[model samples]
Target: MTFSAVARSADGDSFGVAVASKFLAVGAAVPAAEAGVGALATQAFANLAYRPEGLSLMRSGIEAAATVNRLVTADAEAQTRQLGVVTASGPGATFTGEECLPWCGGVADDGYAIQGNILTGPEVVEAMQVAWLAGDPATSLARRLLAVLAAGDRAGGDRRGRQSAAVLVVRPGGGYGGTSDVEVDLRVDDDPAPVEGLERLLRLHELYFTRPDPATLLDLTGDLAAEVTERLSRLGHPGEPDAALAAWAGMENLEERLAPGRIDPVVLDLLRKA
Candidate 1:
């Protein structure tokens, strides 16, 4: 009924889970993670308690396999559960219950776990794992996870069908306004094409939440500066161009991309288009 991947960033500063299922709002139930701790996905007959309990065990220095063992041992219906886990320190693990539907299984690697129940075939999970292994480690974890999910879905996702998808990534101070580690948490509760919907939301998340690279900053000066100032004035921002640009970026929740003497070219383009 679901396919999921739990992973930690190459730098070990972040961890997250991405999941999709024929089940409604799969995100609300299947995926869970904590920054600098670990991540887990519980499906088949998902045990809600396994989420917090698994994370707590990992936080207390338990290995990913041991965490799965503990959770399954405590559950009376363990044979019906499918679980995946990735520890912050790089170990990973997965489990598929004997009573799970046909084509149910998993693959675990050094830093990630991919699992699913009632999938099209082992190829669905194989495609996901291959995509994850082939992903550029330097890229954002959310994008990496989403890419693999797209691959899995294209390979004939959930034999039951697609109703929802979600991606969650966490890091220290990764959340908006520096208030949390929920770097990216998106859910398409009942979309017919939930994986595609998740990808769309992820692109928006990158725009609003990611910091611009300094190498891409555009200096405000001469004709460009004048144009920017005029645009700001037209937008009802009456002030020095630099100050107005700063104010505008702040209003758009893009202040982190601001530099004292220049603005991110993308931010300028976004402002121009607005």
Candidate 2:
């Protein structure tokens, strides 16, 4: 009913999980991660406790394989669950219980784990592993995870069909305003194409919450300033262009991209489109 990948960034500073399934709101059940600790997905009669408990074990310096072993061993219904785990260092681990439905299995290697149960076939998890391995290390962990999930979807995901999808990524100072570890947490529950929906949400997340790249900052001056002022005036924000732009950005939830005496290309493009 589900397929997932859990991974640590190439630099080992980030960790994430991406999953999609025939289950409703699978995000709420399958994925979990903590910055500087580890990530895991528990499905097929998921034991929710495995989330926090697994993170704790990883934080205490337990390796990924050991953490999976400990969790399954302690559970009386171990044969009914599937799990994948990756920590800040070393190889990851994947587990598929003998009692899980047909087409259930997993694969793991350095820094990543891919797993699924009741999937279309072994190809689903295999495609995910290929995508994860081939993804550009320079890309954000969230995007890489999404690519893996999308690959699983393209390869034929849950045998029952798709209903939900989600991506979770974490890193130190990666959250909104650097206030938390959650770098990206987007979900598409009950969607006909949940992976596609999740991709759109991830774009919005990057635009709104991520700070502008310094190299792309455009100085607010001359014709650009005049055009901005005119645009703001037309939008009923008549004032100094910078001040009006600031006010508008706050309202639009784009304050994260604001910089003194400059505008992000994304903000300017949005203004023009508006």
Candidate 3:
């Protein structure tokens, strides 16, 4: 039993999926997406092939509905599978097979799709849709998807309870080292509170992967510089404040937050607190 959504960013630059299930490692089986193509989730006897095949079909210029229809129609156990699809710059589509368990269904709208099987009630999907549609378009897709997934969980989620949760978001040159599209791919495979665990991981992901806004950069100077120098010296750093700050950030794996010639405000705060 699972509840999931496949969505594209309002700016058409990102796509992702967020899912929660009473199944172990639901992310490994339920969700798939590519930067410029589309995203989908297959549950309720999920056909793993739908992942790559559905992406291929969408990449070939198929819209969400046509791609989902083709996949569902060709499946031998079509009546037992639940599916959702959303293209990078097109509409969304969802399918819930007749043979799926009770309270199984879905909703599809422009740029997003939500679906689930063996959920508490229609409210589970409704809460997700409402949260999703009400989100700020400027918010990151990963955060938006997580917001809806959290709402669905609050609305009773899968009747069988939670065991796993995951979120995957992608954009051009968004992955580690900027050579791939996987901006974020996180999973809480067996946590009692997987959504919360997932949220924590998302925070860490942002801290390590995203660059700080220029407006948020804090220049280490004067008293702050002197204080940083003192702290660095006490921590066994032996150099100017700026160089030592860079070394500390590198040691903490926070190089992404560094600016060309300034310290990050968050880094300053972290050093102060430490």
Candidate 4:
């Protein structure tokens, strides 16, 4: 009832999973990752234990294929389960049990795995693999994963239909405020178009949580500064423009993009729309 991709960043600093399905809250069941360790997706009678246990194995120096072998070999229900695993190094691995519903299978390469069960056809997994291989390595792992998921979705995802989707990426100090390993974790628990919803949430996440690109910073000056001041005043923040902008950004959870003597284009656009 689901399709997923698990991958490590080209630089080996990140690991992530993106998945969508007709299942309710597929995110809660299918995807898990740990910074500097590995990632996995367990579905089709998914054994939730595979998540933590698989990461622990990878953390202990086990490669992805071996970790998968250990998990499935020990499970009595292995024939009904499907899993995908990828580590920071070594080849990725995917498994589709013989008893899984029709149109179930997977593919894996050195850095990624794509898998699905109860899917529309082999095309779903094939499209995802193509997207992953073609994605620019310079892009964030989260974005690349999402692109793969979207490709699978476009190619006809779960044979049942779409109900939920999620993307999870991890890297050391990659979470908000650098306090955690979760780089991006967004979910659409129940949506008619969950992949598209996930995409919108990712864009918002980048704007609010990521630091502003130095090259895109605009110095506060001339008409731009005057317009910013006017907008702040209208938003009931009539004060030094910079201070008011800071206060407003704090309220909107956009403080990460704040910089002295400059404005992020995203912030400026939000202020204009406000």
Candidate 5:
């Protein structure tokens, strides 16, 4: 019913996961991460407690393998569970329950773990690794991990077929209102093309939800504004001084830029029509 993969950038600055299943609400049950801590994905008879408890373990200096050992060892139903963990320092570990369905297994390494159960075969995991190996860090981890998830689909993803898909990422200070973990937590709970739907949301997250620093504004003026406005107009947006950008000099999407509150009119004016 589930197939999932977890990975981190070689430098340890980013981490992510991609999962899909015939089951409902996979994200809420499968993925968890903490900035400066680590990530954990619990499934195949998932013990939901592992999500929080694993991160707590990592936060207290437990490495990936040890953290996983502690969790599985403490669980009375360990033999029926599957788990994956990646530490902030890039230690990685994965486990698949011996009792899981056919083609259930996983791979673990220094910086990531790729796992699946009730999958097509080893091909599914292979596709995931091939995709990740080809990823470019210049891109967002959301895009990279989603690429792996998409690859799994190409190679016969969840043996039961897809219903929901999700992506999760965390960074030191990459959340709204400047607090809490969650750099990115997106899901397509029920989509005909869950991976593609998740990708579209990722694009939105990259452009708006992921804010560049205040210094980023300094480089945009004149021709740069013109270029950006052209890009916005092509995306069904108005290149004008809208309320959305009142806090800065740009045209911002209403739903995305409204978070910090104020709409910077000057920023909007500058962002309007170059």
Candidate 6:
């Protein structure tokens, strides 16, 4: 019913699954990730059991292949199960039920699981892996995953066609009330440009939800702050130097911040760091 990839980074700091399908709630079902743990994507008559069970198997010191083997063995419909996994340990594995549609295959290596089923072709997953491996290791997993999804789209993804896409990545204490199990969870449902939409959301998360990178920090002092005030003055937020500087210096605090639109302050940060 879908093609999916579950993988970890070369540095093992992130683990994620990027999946696009003609399926609904793909994010809630197909993508399972835990920071400092493991990741998995189960599809093609997917067994939701794979989410928790697979992770449990991994935590118990099972390899991706063996974990998958255990899950499928217990499943009466193993012929219709397609699974891919990457462990926090940087191990990788995949399985495409012999009953899966054409262009179904996967590559598991280097802390990554790249796979797809009922796909445009094997090239989709291959291109995704190549794009990811070529990406900057220090880049956010969301960005790297977005790159792969874009590559998949370019490669003619989802033989049944695309309607939605989702990404899930997590870390310790990353969940809401420590129960949400997400560092980043974005879904684009029923969109003509789901991956692009997801990218926009990811950028927003980076700006507001995630910490500011050192390069993203800028001195909110001096003439640069003045420039920011002058620039934002016309944006209806009151262009007074103090207000603008305050906004730039994060006067409203990070809680009131909005993404990609905080260009004025970011310019100050850029200039300050330069």
lDDT of 1 by residue, 23-125 (tens): 9999999999998789999999999899999999999999999999999999889999999999988579999999999799999989999999999999999
Which candidate achieves the best TM-score against the true structure? 2
**What is the C-alpha lDDT profile of model 5 across 1-274, one tens digit per residue?**
6778777766677777778887888998999887777788998888999998998999999999999999999998887788889888855899887887878888887778888888989899888888877888777777888998999998999888888999998876777645856789999998767888888988777766666444333333566556545655655664552322332333344234432423333334535544
Lowest-lDDT window of 10 residues in candidate 4?
233-242
Q: Could you list the CA RMSD of all candidates, in the order they appear?
A: 1.3, 1.1, 1.3, 1.5, 5.5, 4.8
Look at candidate 3 and give me any clashing residue pairs.
none
Supply every candidate's count of residue pairs whose N, Cα or C atoms clash at under 3 angstroms. Answer: 0, 0, 0, 0, 9, 3
Residue-level error in angstroms, candidate 6, position 187 = 0.3
Mind giving the per-residue lDDT tens digits that candidate 6 earns over 1-274? 6666676766676778888887776777788877777899998788898899998988888877788789889988887888889887846888888887777888888677777888988789888888878989887777788888889878988888777889887666554435555778888877766778888888776665665455554554576556666565654456655555446446434432333423335444543453
> In candidate 6, how many Å is residue 9 off?
2.3
Over 20-125, each residue of candidate 4 has an lDDT whose tens digit, in order, gives 9998999999999999899999999899999999989999999989999999999999999999999879899999999999799999999999999999999999
The true-versus-predicted C-alpha distance at residue 191 of model 3, in Å, is 1.5
After superposing candidate 4, which stretches have Cα over 4 Å from the reference? 221-223
- TM-scores, one per candidate: 0.96, 0.97, 0.96, 0.95, 0.81, 0.81
lDDT of 2 by residue, 1-274 (tens): 8999999999999999999999899999999999999999999989999999999999999999999999999999989999999998999999989999989999999999999999989999889989998999989999999999999999999999989999999999999889999999999999999999999999999989988899999999999999999999999899987899999998999999999899999999999998
lDDT of 3 by residue, 224-255 (tens): 77888898788778688878878888888887
Query: For model 2, where is the 10-residue window of minimal lDDT?
Result: 233-242
The CA root-mean-square deviation of candidate 4, after full C-alpha superposition on the true structure, stands at 1.5
lDDT of 5 at 99: 84
Worst 10 residues of 1 by lDDT: 254-263
